[model samples]
Target: MAALRKAIQELKQLKEQCVEEQGVEMAALRETNQELQQQKQRCVEEKDKELAALLKENKTLKQEKQRCVEEKDAKTAALQKTNQELKQQKDRCAEEKAVKIAALRERNQELTQLKEHCVKEEAKMAALQTKNQELKQQKSRCVEEKDAEMAALLKENQTLKQEKERCVVEEVKVDKKEDVEVKVEPEVRHDVKMNALEIEQKLLRGNIEELNMKYGKLLKIHEKDKAEMAALRKTNQHLKQLKEPCVEEKDAEMAALQKTNQELKQEKLRFLEVKHFEIVVLHERNHELQQQKERCVEEKDAEIVASHERNQELEQQKERCVEEKDAEIVALHERNQELEQQKERCVEEKDAEIVALHERNQELEQQKERCVEEKDAEIVASHERNQELEQQKERCVEEKDAEIVALHERNQELEQQKERCVEEKDAEIVALHERNQELEQQKERCVEEKDAEIVALHERNLELEQQKERCVEEKDAEIVALHERNQELEQQKERCVEEKDAEIVALHERNQELEQQKERCVEEKDAEIAALLKKQLKKPPKALCVVKEELVEVKVELEVEQEVRVDQPEQTNEPIPTTQRRTTPRWRRVINSFYCIRPNVNDD
Candidate 1:
């Protein structure tokens, strides 16, 4: 009985210790459960914060994308407007160029007509000068003949005076001889001398009449020469008037040509100015476009950086959440290990207590013969209490197992959520990379287009330069041709002046020759009159009259011959046809080449 009591006391002490241990374990389990719940709440809050941040970043990205798109659209519109303006400017320039070209063509045609008129006028002037030269020659010859006749008449008068003096001397001699011969045959000799003297006087009067007629003819010829000189002077005045008008017209045409040239130069300068302005505008536009592109690139880079930063932030948050969850999971695992260890210790304690109870039961059975019934009743009640405590422990273990299963399911769900978040982040990163690639491709395309445009502009500039060079060359050729024409005109004027001077010198020389001829003819006529007077002294008075009439007829014949010579120049001065075949074709070719060149330049 004492042993039973001792065993019962020990059992009571062991039960008390086990109950205290169970209570401590229950407190630890409750604390762990509370800590797990708090950790789960913190994880849920962090997840919520992260989700909110992600949503905000996504919204910001969308807004930035929309803004970028709007900016791009605006830039494109501006570029289109600039292009349209450039096209309009180009069209205006083309129209202006065409107008200028047409005007130049008309000017060229007018110049060509003026050139033709000038050539015709020059040819007419040359013909008129030749005719005037021929007329001058005829007039000079007529004047020469008149001078010779005048000299002859003067010589004849001198011969007649000498003849009268000789006749007076002969009459005195005849008187002296007749006084001496009067005794021989006075009546017959006196009658013969008187009759002979009378006949000689009559012949002298006839010669005087012939000389008067020749003087009258010479006076008439002199009058005609003066009239011819007056006509030649009038013709010269008319030619001078005509030449003055022609010179004035030439000057006007030259001034017009110069004006046209000035206008062309002004137009060229204006065109150059316009081209320069266009180039400057193009450069400005290019600069603006480049600036806009740079700004866009900067914006895109900023957006990309922001996205990268945001992604990094999300990744960091995810890492932090994962770390935190891992820590929580590790803590839960540690708590579970600790709970399992406590449960095993509790089970070991229960097993040791059961073994002790079995030993005690054996000892009690051996000692039961000496024990009382009250002790048995007490032992049965204690055993029932132990069984109830074991049942409660089992219930607690089942509840802990259920809690562990729930925690395991929650951790699995969190893992799935973390995996889904990782997948979503990866997908978003991939999308961002694709968007970046597309943007880069678009930039490349734009750059290529710009390069192509620049190349085209360069080619256009080259073509314009070539056209400008060709135009300069044409202008130079035209200038050279104009200079050559001016030189030719100057040379022609010099030639005409020289010809006029030579004609004047020739006229003076002919006048001198005619004066000499007139002096010689006067001497010869005096000699002939002296011989005729001597012959008449031996011949009949009727024969002397016949000789006088024949001399008059010869003078008339000479005058008629001079008139026939003067009319001969008219037949040689027939109008000649002008040939402009070479100049016409050359001008036509030049115009055709210009037309061809213009179209080719425009095409380029």
Candidate 2:
């Protein structure tokens, strides 16, 4: 009865301790919640200011649109006055465009003639590029090999670090032992660890020495390459120096030739004049070739500088990659801290678990101390066994954790490699598909006997497309919930602003509709103008048709704008999300006006 009372008293004390801890944690959480609320309020205030700015921008955009409309009306009025003038200009433009096209066609013919000359130059450039590529490849191979070695060293360093840390922790545990004999086992283990670490450090020093030797060799090779490059630069400089005097001498000879040709022109009139002109063209081409040679020299110098920078960058990148791999191991300490924090949080959350854990820990500590004292005389043999088992369990757990982390890293690397492979293959596969499509199109055009095969292939493609669509649908369905959840959360965050801006959003919608209608009306009017201009140049314009077209354009714009204004406001009272806004047609019209009209300018 007395023992039961004592146990009950301990339980009460444990409960009290748990309550106190919970109270402290609750106070901390409340403070954190209050801080978060204040921050959120500040964010809301800032967002309100941003909303006001956006509203101002909206008004400015509206003003710009109105200005654009006014400008369009004025432009239309001026265009009516200048319609006759534009017809004359359009004829002049067409003639100019035709002459330009002919000139371009002649230029293409000239370029084709020049392609034969450039072929030899291109071959020479290819040879130079190949040489550069080979040198780059060699440097890349060296960098890759160095990176591999560095990675190996990094792994070794990490293992050594882990072992060193384990030893330190073991030393800390050993320090807590009361008995000298009990401490003796840990002390011996510590000595063995210290010896192992010293031996490993020695090995590391030897590896470092070997790496230094290799690095020295590499440096020597780099110096030799640098000397070769310097020699090449000197040779290029010498060539340039030689070419300058030769070019001057050629110019002198060409001037002398021109004097002779001019004298010959008196005897052989038109024929000599044409020959002289041909000679001048050849000289110009010679000058251009000389300029190209200079450009090539400058480009080669740039490439050499780039290669040097690239080599340095590669070395730095390799070092960073190795260091990053080593840095990953540092996260193990962070993970341990996170686990401790998680445990504290779990204890804070679950009073029963914390209380039970406290009870068990206290009971175990008491029993262990009491048992050690009581058992020492009775069964001193058990001490070493218990200590060994505990050490072995700890080591096993640590090894397993290390193995898991290593495996996870390996798995990630494999996944990344697989994704890269897939990406590379996808490009090739797409090219192959395009080639097949081209073949099919060619077959269809040629009325081939393999029509049956093509039909079968087409059917198969359709089936595959259907299957792809099904797969896409399934994937979309899976992804939609996740997207919807995210959107909902975002909407909830912005709901405060959204409610206040509902009227503004509705106004925006109406304005957007009006803008769309205005753009369409403008586009139709421009297209009508282009057509009218085309007609006026081709045939005399009918006054009745022109008047009807202008009236129709004005009425259409007015009706569309009025309809949009009436309908948009009623339906758009609820705030529409930015993401859900439809893409307006004005962008398409602008693109069409710029990109499409020019191509068809001479098509008619």
lDDT of every predicted structure (CA atoms):
0.61, 0.57
Cα lDDT of candidate 2 equals 0.57
TM-score for every candidate vs. truth?
A: 0.35, 0.20
Given candidate 1, what's the lDDT at residue 34? 83
Q: What digit string (tens of lDDT, one per residue) describes model 1 on residues 426-489?
A: 7878987886676568557656755765687799999999999999999999999999999999
Best by TM-score: 1
| Tens-digit lDDT track of model 2 for 1-604 | 9999999999999999999999999999899768756865665675576567657756765675465445434533443344334335434544644454454344334333333323322333344445556766876787787688778768877986897698678767656552455736766766886797689778878977887898788778878777866765574465456446544654564465456446533534553364357436534643453354344233334433453465467558657855864674465457556755764565455544433443354364455446435534423333353345446534644654464455446446544654664576577568657866765675454445345546877999999999999999999998998899989989897996787687677687677886796688678767865664554453324643544464466556556755765575667665555653565544334334433423214555
Candidate 1 regions off by >4 Å?
1-67, 119-123, 126-134, 153-285, 297-604
C-alpha lDDT of residue 546 in model 2? 47
lDDT accuracy of residue 325 in candidate 1: 56
Clashing pairs in model 1, backbone N/Cα/C closer than 3 A: 148-518
